[model samples]
Target chain A: MNWKRLAPPLAVLVLWQAGSTAGLIPGFKLPSPLQVLGGLADLALRGMPPGHRLHVHVLYSLERVLWGYGLAVLVAVPLGILMGWSRRVRDWIEPLVEILRPIPPLAWIPIAILWFGIGIRSAAFIIFLGAFFPVLLNTVSGVRSIDPLLIEAAQMLNAGRRFIFLKVLLPGSVPSILTGMRIGIGIGWMSLVAAEFTGVRQGYGLGYMIMTARDIQRPDEILAGMLVIGLIGLGIDGGLRLAERRLVRWR
Target chain B: MALHLEIEAIQKVYPSESPEGRVEVFHRIDLSVDPGQFVSIVGPSGCGKTTLLRIVAGLEARTSGRILLDGRESEERDRRIGMVFQDYALFPWRTAVRNIEIGLEIQGMPQQKRRSLAMKYVRVFGLEGFADKYPKELSGGMKQRVAIARTLVANPEVVLMDEPFGSLDSQTRNRLQDFLLRIWRERKDTILFVTHNVDEAVYLSDRIAVLSPRPAAVCGIFDVALERPRDRTGPEANRIRKEILELLHRPHTSPVTF
Candidate 1:
């Protein structure tokens, strides 16, 4: 919304265009924006590989992210709230989560392939791990940050434990929960590329197509695939920002 | 509804690091408010005035004592109590009207009935224009008005205020005092107001209870006896204020039970 904030990206684009025009980049190594767009148009209209349009590749990755991120939210949010609200739960799980969280989601790829065997399910599992930690950790932080006075006020108003949890704790932690979900979605999206790079079958995801293009020596197609990934990632992030602005009207 | 209140020998002590390693805050304090009588507690800071009020409100427990409301001991009964906090303590997320209706909503009152009741107080306090506005949107005095309206919406039997106007400017405080006096006169429910301001104590109270410092004990209770609608700048009010201030300033020593 602020033009001044957007100047960096505009300047980078201008520099890239200038560098390409001045022949600073070797043609085989670096394609101009126009060349990338032309290759992108070709990939979008004509099939990238075996009846798979670039849009289909994007949709394949998107489907995996949605399922994984959705499941992560369903499981992690309540667990995070429980861990935050009670000391016993936190003590029991905190150590396990701490040790596991530092391990990148990609590190689980071998186990995921062994368990689910080179399919969408394997990809979804890796994406789930990517999303889960961010949402869970952020949700816990959010609940802990709530003001004690608000809790006292709810207590004085004769709110029961259930009512307080639902009405006070949940709404109070919403902004933080949303923040966690946004971070989780982004991480999950990033993890999907690696997840799809494994032995996926019956479909071409953006990750799969990028690898295939690299093998076939179509660097332009590889660049186009990377551009699509960046654009889609940016779009998802923008959607979250819009939702955050609308939902956190109080904040 | 009327409240026949009783406080039977309430004692409070806090741990300290002196020769005794403990200090008595309040000592076997006994007081009672008759049905519909407005009693005000005046004392210096750190005198456990607010502690005493909290004990009565059931927000805190006494060291050893009993509080009876209408002849029965105050247990976990909801007693139709109202509280106006010094900081206004309105929920930041709720609008003025919503804040006023919060107690009713908790009681599961229907939305229309709650709104109707909340609207009456909103109109009475000249807060109709700001009914839909949040606490942050209102000025200090306006927020206090909303707080009073919020308390009054429940039609509470006993309204406990802890320095309700302590944070406001002098002009707003005076205006709110006059407004409070009018509300008390009209409603006449049992009101226990705790304040450190001597002028405010005499101006609004039917009877002023002066409390001692630190290990708080009630030194004495003085009947205001000044005329109603007592103007802050009026001669009678000034005389009463000076008398109350003199009582508050007196150095008294008595052996208080821990």
Candidate 2:
């Protein structure tokens, strides 16, 4: 009876619908739940006037997140590990990372769009900025916190520096790295929303859909877009959880 | 292939927080163990037994003096010394067999040979059914057994054990003591066991090295000379245990608690 899980939302929907019908709520400003659902169905079929389906918007948003998040991982993990493993590297890079870290992803939007220009590249660059630090910091701390005893044991067993790095350090930092990924993905999704507000030619993304619908005063379409964005985020996070279960089974 | 060790006046010092600019752990600590001998060092806490063991295994550097493993200087020695830390220090991510495979991995042994060698120790340690199990899945005693097996797989002539059974229950402690004795007898290994327990020292060691207080030195060395499967509750066991305890419990000039 996870219908209990739906109880609060259902109650809120009912209240909103009743309030709108009773003229307690401005009807156009806050659409009914049924109107939002109907809007979602219409968007699924006729494709939002530009002939782009709901699936097309989802794909565009999903691909942007994947590219940006992927690049962040590719760059950050190695950099983080190097910083953690070597004091020299950390001293060289840490101050720079700290300076850059406090700046929010949205603040970088104008410069990102300037560099990559109003397309998937600009959106992905913004998302990369969003995802980078959490992943990097967590990974660095993970490597730094590895038990010195384990490394000593490996050394006594005649393990070389490279062997210790691969066998001990890599596996030890995995759980923390996964934690970084989960957090980074959420921030990356949020950054994509802001990035998409800049718009792309011939592009249909849930964020772009919400922005245009807002300009046209279609609250129903905006709500539908929000619902889809939330559902996609939930699905991705759920998948990450499943992967986490396997990776950190030892813990 | 038992190995002999000569610990020549090993010492350690830490930078002090107090008025004394430095704290010497132990200095002029001299002891020698013949090949295949089982020696245990017992003392008050913070007497630096673990540090001495680490120095012997080349895990830590002594502030002064040196260690000789089978006539070779510590640095020149290969992976001939194995150390079993008090925490057991088994890698959580590795299976019992995989943990044993680590030493072989360092030697760049072929995969098939590594697996077979690891499986051999897995069976030797009676980890047959649990060979594939990760360290988290094993019980404390079993984890220690796996830790021992992992070290044994390295085929070191000398193994330094830092309170190998210190964390176990009394029954488990007694069981592991006998198990360790059996491994030493069968493998013909020289074991430098460090512990705080007098009974454990008297029960397992061929000789017990008693250290004085902080910045400790080998104050006395007592030979067990007891029979195999030594009685833990025997009169001689108590007598020697008491003698070692007395050596360890000498009145301290400083206000150090044991």
Candidate 3:
């Protein structure tokens, strides 16, 4: 709500509106904000390329990211906590995780396709790998950074290890977990684009629509698609930030 | 509500820089605390006062020792042991009240009882308005008070504080010292306080045990014998401080090992 923060984006929007109105950009290459909004409405009402609406594309991408990101949190967080808490766990998994972590999410797309075929499952697999390492690494770092005195205090109170994990460890790691989630979401968003371009079908993700527009030489529509993607990503990031502020009220 | 503690021939040794040697921190330490006694251990930095306190708290295992509570072995006793750290150690994610209730919650006290007991300590510490506040929102002194309250809220038989006021500013530390003295007077719980501050040791403790530096051992024990409701600025307080400082300044080489 701070006007200072809103200034830069507002200025950019005004400039974009002015440039498009003055015909400063080639019509074939760029679309105005108004044009993109109109295109968005058209896409919503009349569907994209064929019979699928914008909601269908969004829902398709959302479902894949949700399942993939959910699985990553489920598997990675506990493993990360264990590794962070014990040197033995870290010794066993750290090298393997470090090796796998450097391989780009896009690099996994071919392997994912080979393993799951070109479908929602393959896209989900790519997104899962994209999201997993960040969350795991962050959770481990978060747990590691916790004050040893806090653990001792909990122990003095006779809180068992299980209670300590639930009551102290999880809540303490939340800020880092949220950071990892934000990073994972960004990675998932980028990975989804590469995932859809690899000849996947029946899934109406925006990445697929954008690629189709590029093939058809409709660059303005492609620009519109890209704009929509950016805005949604911004919106989701903003929503997560708000949620982080509320849930981590203590911090 | 009162209990006795016996410490019999405790020792702690750490690996020395030389691979072939071990440095003894404390050797053949012996002490006893009568029911409701308040004792403080004071020494220079790296004196292992904290190490000894940790051993008594059962947070650290002594190299060799026997700790008895109420005439029974500490391992077999069901006495509640509470600790307050120098950092306050309040769970940042929990509210003041919840942090206080953590010990009782761990004891599996019913939620209603935990809340009720937590509320009592919260009010007792004059933290009524800050019950829902997080550690970040509270000042350092307030956080320390909450930490003390949290440790006492479980109705622990003995409280172990390792330099609890060492992290506070001078004025805040002084205020908390008075607050702690008032609480000990009213609650009558056994307390073992560790600090390098001779003044603090004299002000709060019924007895002050001076510890030698690193490879530490008890150098001397002096009973303050200052009357109850001891004042920081009073003449009696000054006398005790002088004695404790004298003990702390006395030099000693390696302790005689068995």
Candidate 4:
């Protein structure tokens, strides 16, 4: 609906198309926008390796992300709350977290393959490593940043320990937790794609399709796959932002 | 049922980085509120009026003190006591009626029963249409009303208010003051209100306890013998306000600890 937003991208695409048609940009190194569109149509209709369709690749990638991100949330949120609420827990766990968090998730690929093998488990583990710290740290900061007066007010209202944790602490930290989730998902999605680039037993992933396109010397398909990955990331982030708006309408 | 509240020999000391290595915020701060009485603690800013209220509410630990509710030494966090804060302290995530229901929910009241009871207060507080609105959506006055309603729905025998109307504009403050008086008249809950506003203290309290500056003690206690719906600018109210102001402005003397 906003023409202003559409105009810049349109202009770039037109310039790119013109450059490709004039041979200023080589096809094998960089495909034109039209060639990328043709590649996309080929992926949807004819599949990447004859039988592995684009939709199947998308579904597999989504499944991996969901599994990894879900597990990260389940483990991180509770741990974060405990770490935030108890000084002893924080003191014990913070050092381990600090030591591990700096290691890139992609760097864990070889170790993860050794541990879980070349299946979905290794990929999920890599994605989990990518997602976990953001969720945990955000949740911790969220809980810690809550107004002490709110806790005091809850105490004055005779809220017991459980009530304070569930009602006051949990709800208070939601905004931060959501922000963490958004960041975690972004990183997890990226890690999943990169993890798939090494190898996938299922032969179905956006990253695998891109790698195969490179092997077959189809720059157009590679560009098309990259665009798909970016669009999916945008969609995932947009979905999270919508959920955040609903959850924190008070903000 | 309202309970008499006694704050006896309350002391608060904070470890400090100064040469003394400790700061005594207040010591031997003693005050008492009769059953169904409205008492205000007025003092200069930073005189520990809020700290005193926090101690009474059992939200802060005192170095040494006893808070007696109806002659019994209350527990660390007495269910019979509740507090309203200057910032309202309403759960921003909760709607008005839900915020009002928080204490009841903590008491393990049945959901339907608590909802109906909270609705009654929503109507009583004239927050009828705004019952489903979150604190952020409400005006400053409405948020305070929700905070007050939240505390009152649980029917706390002793209500500790620490500058509950401090953040509002003068007009909203006056309106809320009147609204609070109306609620007090209806409920007759024992209230210990803290404020820096001398006029507010005079206009609302049955008794005003003036605290001296830091390491504070009750410097003076004045009974406001004014009748209900008393004029804010009346001779009696003005006279009491002026006396309290003068007491606040006086140079601090070493507090006498009992």
Candidate 5:
């Protein structure tokens, strides 16, 4: 709502338009903002490849991210709680996590395609890999960061092991878990786009649409696709922040 | 109902990196609290006062000791024993009333019953409007009140307080002391309170036990027979405070029997 916050980007856009008009910027390399906006209109009305609309591509991307990100949260949270709660579980799993964590999600694309073939499954698998570590590591740190005094206080109240885990550890680590989830989804969304670039069986994805645009030398459409990706990423992160605020209102 | 608590020949030793291989925090620390009596343990800093209370509360292990509750050897993690920590230790996530209900919830009491019971203490502690507020929203005095209410609502046989008001400003401390006295008078709960303030000990305790420096042990026990609402700066209270301070200031030597 603040005009001051809008000024910098507006000024940059004006300068970019001026440079493109002056022929100082090559249109073949990067299109002006107006060209990208026109490309967005073309994608919405005429479709990227004449029949596959921009909305369809967005839907496909969202579906893959949901499947992957959901599975990552389901697995990582409980496993993370165990690893954080018990040194035994952590000792058993930590080495494996360490070995796997540093490998980029894109690096897993070849193996994922080999395992699941060129479909949503391979794309989802890559996203899952991208999301898993952030959630897991954050959850571990969340549980560990709890003050020992709070646990002792709960114990003094005669809280049993189950009660301690459910009431104390779970609630105490929620803020950290939410943070990890936000980061995880961000990474997962990014990985989904990259995985689509490798190959998608359905022929419907933002990355694939951009690839088609590149094949036809449509730089404006490519930039438009990138803009959509950026905006959606911002929306997702903003939604997560809102959820975090609601859950951790005590802070 | 009130209960008698007896700590017999308690000792604590921690492993050390030094040549001695172990550090004796305290040795043969003995004390007893009669039913409905308020007892205070006052000692110098790092004299193992908090450790002693933790042992009594079964939160920490003693190298050697027996904690007898109403003449029976108390079991580990005794539910009948409750503690109020110096930092309040209120769960920041829970509201004031919910924090008070924690003990009852652990006992598997029905939600409605615990809520009503916790509400009663919220009023009793004068935490009326703040019952639904979280710990961060409350002041230090309010948080301590919530902490005390949290411990007391469960009706533990004996309450162990480790400097519960130590973090509060002087005025809040005095107000809380008076608040505690009123609650003690009404409930007649057996209490073992630990504090470093000689005046606080003199004001609140029915009996004050003084502990010497580490390898701490009870060096003196003075019966404060002063009347209720006793003036803090009064002659008798000051005299007893002076005596305890003198005992505490005396150089660390062999434990002296009073």
Candidate 6:
């Protein structure tokens, strides 16, 4: 059914290849399409660093997102549920979340490095900041938005509080929570570039590759790194779409 | 038939700070139903027919008065009770069989046992081919069938239906009415059907209770003495329909479908 959806992207790719071959795109600041492709192959075979592969950079970025986003889900979902269920918890936690959420995640990087000492922990912390609020707010709204009649129906059918929570509330809020996860992942990806810029002092990732390439005026490598990041982000969202289809099929 | 349920002096007050201090949705509403009876509550839109049913089903707390089941006051909903909502409320994430399995699952029936029981009702409701389909995948009529099958499979002592067919088109509504009559006759299930449609109330109910405007009270209760599978266009049916419409003076207030 989505076969027609591919046409626009393909057309853009064709135009990009044509523009590159015709030298219509400036070579100094941008790479030709073929040069970018070649750059990708070069990185795959022999990476920017001594022994690391292209997959390593990708995995580093992905692993950071997984840990950060996973931690956000783990922490925020329960807190959101508690806030949704009880006025006391909501009132207590509301001010803190509201205050902290508005500040962009990059603002926290310097403090995160000071707190976490500049490595994977620091990167994960910043990404977590980027992701936590979306999941928390969405879960809260999801739980709040449940049709009360559904809960009443469950109770009328003899469901205990625990059963109603697990069966009625959780399933009812799933579509909303899934929406939160999608948005959270995108933000997590965006923050990955900034998070990795925090001077890890060891192996570098795609973000570091882009930064180092910019210093060397190798836009080809920068474009290739960006392509990988974009492609991987697309893949992650694609996985979520598949899960949305499987888990929330009725919607 | 034995007296099955008695709702006595029921009152519901929606807390408000208006000049009257609080808005009373309904008060001192008294009614009783016998076992194996089909009763319909018909009224204008705001007469609280639904609120009365929900109170009877124990989904909402009554401000005062007692609900007697088998001659004893009890606030807890009977496990042997089921309700069909106006929206069908089929749990969009579940298939037809799984939706029907909720009641049994709450009863702690084993998975295989519940599945088979659901399958049986799927056939009973002529939902054979659509059992595995999700609620959105089915037509309006089909979804309503699944909702009914879900409640009937519970083998409830009383089934409360709140404008269940209000969402269907006229043709589907008539067909479902016939299908429901067949099922009701076969099981002799006690039902408290709520609606605003005078024709529907007069046609399906053994006793039709007319409800007055807000702070809903039972205006009157008239018995339908016609034979089984009563003709919709028959003279007696027509007379009862007209009488019921006149009784529910704020008539033709069909609840919005979906």
Number of the predicted model whose TM-score against the real structure is largest? 5
Which tens-of-lDDT digit does each residue in A21-62 have in candidate 5?
A: 999999999889999999999998888888999999999999
lDDT of 3 by residue, B1-258 (tens): 867878889998877787768888787788888889988888888878788888888888888988878878856323466788888999999999999888889889999999998999998898989999999999999999999999898888878899999989999898888899889889899888888998888888888888777666677888888876677779878877887677767666656789
Supply the TM-score of chain A against the true chain A for every candidate structure.
Answer: 0.93, 0.96, 0.91, 0.99, 0.98, 0.93
Q: For each candidate, what is chain B's TM-score? A: 0.93, 0.94, 0.92, 0.96, 0.96, 0.93
Q: Which should have the higher DockQ, number 1 or number 4? A: 4
Give the Cα error of residue B40 in candidate 6, in Å. Answer: 1.6
> Worst 10-residue stretch by lDDT in candidate 4 chain A?
A42-51
- Tell me the RMSD of model 2 versus the true structure: 2.2
The local lDDT score (0 to 100) that residue B230 gets in candidate 4 is 88
For DockQ, the strongest prediction is 5
Q: How well is candidate 2 docked (DockQ)?
A: 0.76
Where does model 3 exceed 4 Å of error? A2-25, A31-38, B76-79, B231-235, B253-258
Q: What is the lDDT of candidate 5?
A: 0.94
Give me the candidate number with maximum lDDT. 5
Q: What is candidate 4's lDDT per residue for A148-230, written digit by digit as tens? A: 98898888888878999999999999999999999999999999999999999999999999999888888898889999999
- Model 6 chain A: weakest 10-residue lDDT segment is A197-206
Tell me which of candidates 1 and 2 scores higher on DockQ. 2
- As for lDDT, the candidate ahead, 3 or 5, is 5
Q: What tens digits encode model 4's per-residue C-alpha lDDT throughout B1-258?
A: 999999999999999998999999997888999999999999888989988998887777899989999899966677788889999989999999999999999889999999999999999999989999999899999999999999998889999898999999999999999999999999999999999999899999999999998889999999999998989999988998888888888777756789
Span of 10 residues, lowest total lDDT, candidate 2 chain B: B70-79
Candidate 4 structure, TM-score to reference: 0.96
Q: For model 5, give the TM-score of chain B.
A: 0.96
- TM accuracy, model 3: 0.92
Q: Give the C-alpha interface root-mean-square deviation per candidate.
A: 2.2, 1.0, 1.2, 0.9, 0.7, 1.4
The full ranking of all candidates by TM-score, starting with the best, is 5, 4, 2, 3, 1, 6
